[model samples]
Target: MADPSNELLASALSGEGQPSVVQLHGEESPQRCAELRWLYPAIKWWKALRLRGEEDLNGIDAYAASVDALLLDAWSPKQLGGTGHRLDPAWLERLEMRICRDLPWWLAGGISAEWVPTLVHQVSPFGLDASSRLEHSPGVKDLRRVEALVQAVRVNSGNRG
Candidate 1:
């Protein structure tokens, strides 16, 4: 969960290339999304929640109502992020698209350059997180890998659109 404080968020938002979305995780409540939206109407909010099983589906509506987008990360009881394992695509298969038709959603976990096209064709998520796959090691990104992944996403996105 990357819950940066408002001051921190303001600092980053002031920098070059203001991000279109900022994701909140863990103890960061959806109220923060409302606060941020009030403060900076230009950016959108994405709240990352861990998905375990069917029972967790109960709160999907409330969650979706609070943010512009949802980021479903694989549930790992022992960890916070980057489990290096993809959530079963079948998990998404059960969802009714009409439920969240207005809200965009994203997927996370072990996504790779090669998986982008297939995934885009399948779920057509609003976006994806490719950090773990683009890294040479934890916290250290490989520039070449990042570039290749970006190229792959662009090509695949064009194909999907």
Candidate 2:
């Protein structure tokens, strides 16, 4: 979730054990990340950046450096993720020679087994994050779809290997 209060983030980190992954979703601004830099050591930070348009290309290096990894997800000013919209692949293409050249990043939103090969070939992300695409309904996962996505990634990876 985005805009998590520092108190809540800290509480989650200190309670029981640290989460294996702590993603900051819909968080695109570097200043916001800088404000939360104190929590860096306590969590495995992964920033889920919303690709609104060309403007998002600004200051991406600082954003990438602030976290352990990056996730490039589709965004609409009207929605808070899981919008079932595809990000403009051209944005990723524009970035291929720049920020994407050395960052550990992933792609998310409206992803499915069929798109994996094309996306992998286009962006070469560290991974893929499937959400609404694998769901039978909001908050309900479809086991078969999930399994198929895994198989697709495995097969595609083997082919690439």
Largest lDDT belongs to which candidate? 2
- Model 2 scores a C-alpha lDDT of 0.75
| Stretches of model 1 off by over 4 angstroms after superposition | 1-21, 27-43, 96-98, 158-161
Error of 2 at 113 (Å): 0.8
Q: Tell me the spans in candidate 2 whose CA falls farther than 4 Å from its real position.
A: 26-28, 100-102, 158-161
Model 1 lDDT tens row, 1-161: 27788788889999799998777777566576667778888888888877787555555767566688888788887887787677776566555343477888788988888777777666677778767777888989889887887887898785643
**How high a TM-score does candidate 2 get?**
0.85
Cα lDDT listed for each candidate:
0.75, 0.75
Per-residue CA lDDT of model 2 for 1-161, tens digit only, reads: 67788787777668576677778885446677756665456556778888778678666778765677888787778877777778877677777657845668888878998887776666667888888899999989999999999988887874431
Task: Tell me how far the alpha carbon of residue 4 in candidate 1 is from the true structure, in angstroms, after superposition.
Answer: 7.6
Clashing pairs in 1: none
Worst window of 10 by summed lDDT in candidate 1: 90-99
